[model samples]
Target chain A: MNALDLDRQLCFALYSASRAMTASYKDLLAELGITYPQYLVMLVLWEEGSNDEGVTVKRLGERLQLDSGTLSPLLSRLESLSFVTRHRSAEDSRRVLVRATAEGAAAKERAECVPARIGERTNLDPASMPELLETLRALTRNLRAEPAPVESPDPPAAPLNSHRASALTARH
Target chain B: MNALDLDRQLCFALYSASRAMTASYKDLLAELGITYPQYLVMLVLWEEGSNDEGVTVKRLGERLQLDSGTLSPLLSRLESLSFVTRHRSAEDSRRVLVRATAEGAAAKERAECVPARIGERTNLDPASMPELLETLRALTRNLRAEPAPVESPDPPAAPLNSHRASALTARH
Candidate 1:
């Protein structure tokens, strides 16, 4: 079958591509002693910085689209690694706030080189990254519109038609 | 940050979207007693028909961009479930051929409704399916262009633009 006929479901492509990308990151993350998802949590914390009000598990889950069943154990693993500390919030005892430690923040410097390493490996131009990011965010929004119980609220809106442009500006 | 920011890596969005999509599938596949990857294998064999020449493990790996490490265990699980069979070829003892059984062929009839069900959950339109699939395949090729040892002499060429379309269209 030719391309037109073989166009498998978008789901399959998403599935395979995601796994392939994760596989590429395996060796890199091994050096950091974290899995891909753990690295993502570190990224969120790094971008927000440690002094900013730490993020809650629910908030992190909402952004990452991961449920507690996965996040809880993952958080514990990171905590065991001393990259993050999770504690019950005083004002809201039910809420758990996750904060990165000094060591965790230090990992960012090492990680800054990571994206470039991956970019080099993939041979995708750094200039074209925003376009790719926009497409992915669009796909994520379209796929994630359905709300689940216990899910965190969506992030504040990016400017209309601003996804690619905003990402591009950030790089510079 | 504008579109160019390295902070806005497409990798995160793609990775998260993929995980979210699979999470959506996990619940759906639970009813069918199959996982997401298993469903893809079923689709391939179903489209090819029960008596069709068995798909080789290497070909499956090539199509899925999976290594023997993952595919071997997964295929074994499928065999245990009686959905497929793996046998060594007499002509080429080193080659293993994977063929679906009658049960596996019949499973497709049960699965015909899965695409629509998943679409309902994700709110993705079938018309948009081609574009999403194309983008994924492009990303996969971009990522796969990196060097890796050839697993077999007859490695399937990157399907890229045409493979998915032909395989999928022939079914409809």
Candidate 2:
């Protein structure tokens, strides 16, 4: 078997599909003056019904599986766009909270058309969406559950590229 | 129904799954000093059996669905690593071609271990992989077929934020 074949790799499949999906979202989002990741944050804030209290940076990070380094800049961009507001928590001065501005929340209504539009493009049976979602969610959960293996402290005697030659030679 | 709900979106599911899957590959790939996308390029070169003639940048772009803006920098980095060689095609000076180096070709042996390791992490039934791939491929095809709606040339009468107020007022 050609183990090196790209078509055989599930990771490649997911990676390609994800990028395609994001591309579909890109132009739609550009009209809203936001990126896909920014839209994701908006979804979270809209769903949480964030008000004056707002969602904390830490909580937003946990929900989005993003670190502060990523979320901070994103939030700042959203703030500059007048789509969101970020302020230090009154109860806890050290904690920062994020809330969608009125425009950000209103952007939701315009966004209402997004999913159906994307759905039409996919030509996927609406009936099958749940099944696909289930499979993908399970895959995500399983993959994220375990940590990747750490590199070996010691180096291999043969250089990395030699492995390809040895394997190919064996195959021939 | 909350159309804006993040959980209800298939795009979000695919987006999350893709990131998690890539994360699973990170440490495994780090040992080889390559990123996931770089590994993808290697997989293609190995499969094509690229020789001195090599694959053109344009051909590589089509296969990977990446534009030159993205591929150029990536190819340069790979060249710096000595995993791949990039040169102007003899027949066409205007066209640059990319081919795997001896080390890059040999790196395939080390990469042979990646799929099985990812499989173990996903814990997906081997029988189910083909089915999932088919579904994802279809999704990608469908999403890529349509162009996003162009933004309005004129500005709205109300501020973008007021759209939220109108939407919320209509809901109440």
Model 2 error, position A100 (Å): 1.1
Steric collisions counted per model:
33, 4
Clashes of 1: 33
CAPRI docking class of candidate 2: acceptable
- lDDT of candidates 1 onward, in order: 0.69, 0.77
Per-candidate TM equals 0.73, 0.84
In CAPRI terms, model 1 is classed as: acceptable
Which regions of candidate 1 fall more than 4 Å away from where they truly are?
A: A1-7, A124-131, A146-172, B2-7, B27-31, B48-52, B92-95, B116-132, B147-172
Candidate 1 residues B50-121, lDDT tens each? 466788888887666677998999999999999999999778989998998888777766777667655655
Model 1: per-residue Cα lDDT over A1-172, one tens digit each: 4221224676777877787788777777887899988988887777664575788999888767778999999999999999999989999999999999988887877787777656655554455455456656665665555533333465224323323234322343
Pairs in steric clash, model 2: A103-B161, A106-B164, A161-B106, A164-B106
